[model samples]
Target: MSSQAAEVTEVLVVGAGQAGIAMSEHLTARGIPHIVLERHKIAERWRNERWDSLVANGPAWHDRFPSLEFADVEPDAFATKDQVVEYFEQYAQLIGAPVREGVEVTSVRKRDGGAGYIAETSAGTIEARYVVAATGAFQLPAIPPIVPADAGLFQLHSSAYKNPDQLPQGGVLVVGAGSSGVQIAAELRKAGREVFLAVGPHDRPPQRYRGRSFVWWLGVLGMWEASAPPQGAEHVTIAVSGADGGHTVDFRDLAASGIRLVGRASGYADGKLTFDGDLADNIRLGDENYLSMLDAADEFIERNGLDLPEEPEARDLGPLPADALEPIREVDLAASGITSIVWATGFRSDYGWLQVDAFDELGRPKQQRGVSVEPGVYFLGLPWQSRRGSTFIWGIWHDAKFLADQIGIQRGYLEYDGNGAPSNFVPRERPAVAAS
Candidate 1:
């Protein structure tokens, strides 16, 4: 390649969100030339896809990058959707990330001679010695094909949902009892709409325990460092909330708040939707995980003999309402007056543009950490990519540093001695950034 090569930089990073920004920060700190390509503006998902009432699940302190703090906000407060986007914008500006927004990357393929990768984009073809796909794990909303096509009912994925007013005036059956589903259901109920949430296998950890935020506990306890889940076990989302200055997400409270709890929506037929008889079982399993976490925290405090106040309310989220424990067998959408269905059913990894054999049967990338089997191709911002916190904004910083170190070694900016460890190779700071 000549100095006048028809390209921008050596390393090409996709997406300008936290992951891409973090990777750009590390690469910049290591004096590596790179360009961050984003299909939309920075923090596009938070700015657009989320609902009006959406708040960050994690506290301000634990959720933000280490480089910048949320300005004019309490550490324990949960930033709103706009505030979160502002924080990302501030962080990217502070780091001077070389982000090229509105440039959509269509596909990435291995170059001939196996030397580099070619990224075909809306702008044009760009070549790079290495490619990092940080587009995000939640690409397409994974709405199950459970809804019959001829049902003639209005349906939207969680990503498309904005406010209660956007939906028609009628009862709403919210599928998927994850954070989004539960929160959205509660909001709809509060708006004077009948809401029924289909409960699934979800883990509920309190927002605060022993007078400390759960985010603090997870970080202090190193719980997020755990590896991926066992095979065949789905990674269920944790049920906790940072809304209203943070609170424990209790289903019993939601039930009491007029949001009926139903079992998982299983099938639809005869103008009625069927449910699995697993609501009680799912709640029981979540309680076990919940109490186990509290017990672990209690044991840690006792073992260390630390002086901390215990909040009894965290342990007992009031009694579960009797009717809430029972599951409704089926729901007649028409009779129930349910005119809208919100599928808060999470998302699927859409790497269709990635023309590489780096994924498994489930469309999950086959890699140790972020390094893919194909040389010069890597991935980031994926949930459980390395640890449980691999997808968190703060958590992804650690992953980005590791990937940057690996890239440095591969690009000869860093080195490993005979001991097969990183040598004492000095790193260079950011140089004058080239035009993206």
Candidate 2:
């Protein structure tokens, strides 16, 4: 290769979110020569887009980066979005990972050599031996098409929502029963707003079990050990399948939490909204199923003579009021005085920028562990990329180690120079940053 050709990095990480940051930590630790390309600034989306009341759904213990742990000064529960950003900032400084912010990647194409790629960005072009797409699923927000037109209601996706204070001083209608929707609805209600949550089926497990955080119990039960079985192994199963398909927040608990529960966001017609008739029944059955599973788990723990803590008897959180259902059928846009609607439906992973044939029938990039269908291309931060919890914060470490090992093994197979850099990449001052 000619020296006039663009400077090549060993690895180019795209999207500087949690996963990107985590990968950077590993790369810096191994003295890998890499650059992280961020479309916006570090932790930009988390800092700018998320709602003010938003805290991580996962507990604080499980949310830190791979090589770092949250200090005891913070609560064990959940960190607010602001705190999360602060942690990532410190992590960036700690690793001295070279991150070029505001450099949007326009295209990623296979280079002629078949062992590298050329990433065209807004700032410039980067030639690298490997590309890691750490852009998470949350980037694409899903919004329904049936939203009432001419209803004069302010609708905002959860990504754009900051707080309820931005909404008009009236009854608020929150759409979706996902974690964000339920939590935001609860926050609004706690603030004395007449808040109604459009309920759908959600998987709700107890945040704490046996008087300890659920994650701690996971560690106690060998759930974190490599020898531990798959998510099917009782304790890890629920957390594993919860996000992709099986996860749901308890609507009965939502009702008990003082948030009004309504049917699914159906359609707006004749100045009123219609909903799925089975929504109420769905919430009831979902909660029953979750609670029953918890009870079954407890029975299994006792039968196996596992060292388990005493569990509180579970109880049913009764259904929503029959009268609340009537008003929700068609909330008067002006009379009900609800100002904002937050769509927390879900996300879509669009890798349209990567012009490559690595995708499967489902359009997801095909890879064995983190290695791609195309050579020299690697992936990280995918849900269940290796195991059930592969994409979660705590689960990312295993994938990182696996990817690092794969890179090392492939380097050995090709006889590439593997031993090259100083042990440390930590910076002595604030890391260089740019805002998108």
Candidate 3:
């Protein structure tokens, strides 16, 4: 390896996704010298990994960075993958974000004697006083290891799946009935293909309730603020779709849309895909949770004495009928003429390059919000980093700005109060508060 001069910056932010870009904007606003390093182009994940037809899970009105809402676009409409990519690109330019694309950070290590940290990247070494691991949570695709290698069927992870045309002319089995699986199954069915969806544990909220978006109700009930998982608890995967119209893609909806629903894919056996015999139970659990959320929202409205219209009782939210609750224990791919298996199992976090002890047993960073254990180290774009909205496109900016303020105070670029806190530390007001 050839030795090169190490470029130094006040802050080095890894990953140029929404989180990183947002952080860079804050740093720029504070006149902090920082550089954002990305392995690919800005919003590379949305640009390259997501399906072509993918849209923002949230509405355009809510999917935005601070001070930069979607313009000339329908606020209630969902932005597609391409539009999202373009939005991030425009945001980076608009904020004058100092980003260095195509620079992949290979390793990050704390410098000797508490000086700072050194980041090894393809473009050479970067020494920074502060290192913000703004890499989004989804670092690696998580396909179950138990998938049969000799199944002799084409396989694609949700991150790699583009469209139904990419699959062979046969039935498709989609494992994991989360957002990705349900959406892909819906697309496959729309393309006139046989789709089998393996149901899993997920939250099934109606896309719209009482003539308003379900997200609006969630905001009304403070779900986003209160939905943070207990510390060390696994985050719940909410099953919702970003497709046109922002429909809810629950197990019931998939089953009712001519897609066969099965239980959780357990493993392969007897030359077939084995599933648990709890399909009905899983569906019931989702329905119960959904109803509970609605009840909570109703209670919140009543308690606040809000002048919202009364929602009708006994409304049909489109769940699976009792007769469609038959459990599917196994599926023989060959017998069913299934040619492809789409694994929407979800993503795993990878911080192997970060040589720091700030990680927990599960390899997740240990932090009280975005500030890591080590001084001058921070994290961004983590799910539930501070609240339920921390990982979303519209929500990460709050964490980013908070981190920027902290970094500014640490670097003496900003002032701190007598209480040893950043003077600029102030909670951002929720936009939905007035509207609700």
**Whose TM-score is greatest here?**
1
Candidate 2, residues 212-321, lDDT tens digits: the string is 45455455554445433434432221311112112235555457666766777888765566666656665655566567656756766787797867656555455455
- Give the clash total for candidate 3: 0
Q: What is the lDDT of residue 350 in candidate 3?
A: 91
Which model, 1 or 3, shows the larger TM-score? 1
| Model 3 Cα lDDT, one tens digit per residue, 60-131 | 888787587776669888888888888989999998899999999999998878578999999999999899
Of the two candidates 1 and 2, the one with more favorable TM-score, higher being better, is: 1
lDDT of 2 at 45: 76
Ranking by lDDT: 1, 3, 2
- C-alpha lDDT of all candidate models, in order: 0.85, 0.68, 0.82
Q: List the candidate 3 regions with Cα displacement exceeding 4 Å.
A: 230-233, 304-314, 317-324, 413-436
Question: In candidate 2, which residue pairs get closer than 3 Å at backbone N, Cα or C atoms, i.e. clash?
Answer: 52-162, 202-248, 203-247, 203-248, 242-247, 273-330
RMSD for each of the candidates:
6.2, 9.0, 4.9
Candidate 1, residues 229-344, lDDT tens digits: the string is: 64654478778877777778878888889888888889998889999988888888788878888998998899889899976666775665554466698999999999999999
Error of 3 at 58 (Å): 1.3
TM-score of candidate 2 on Cα atoms, chains taken together: 0.81
Q: Score every model by TM-score.
A: 0.92, 0.81, 0.90
lDDT of 2 at 272: 62
The pairs that clash in candidate 1 are none
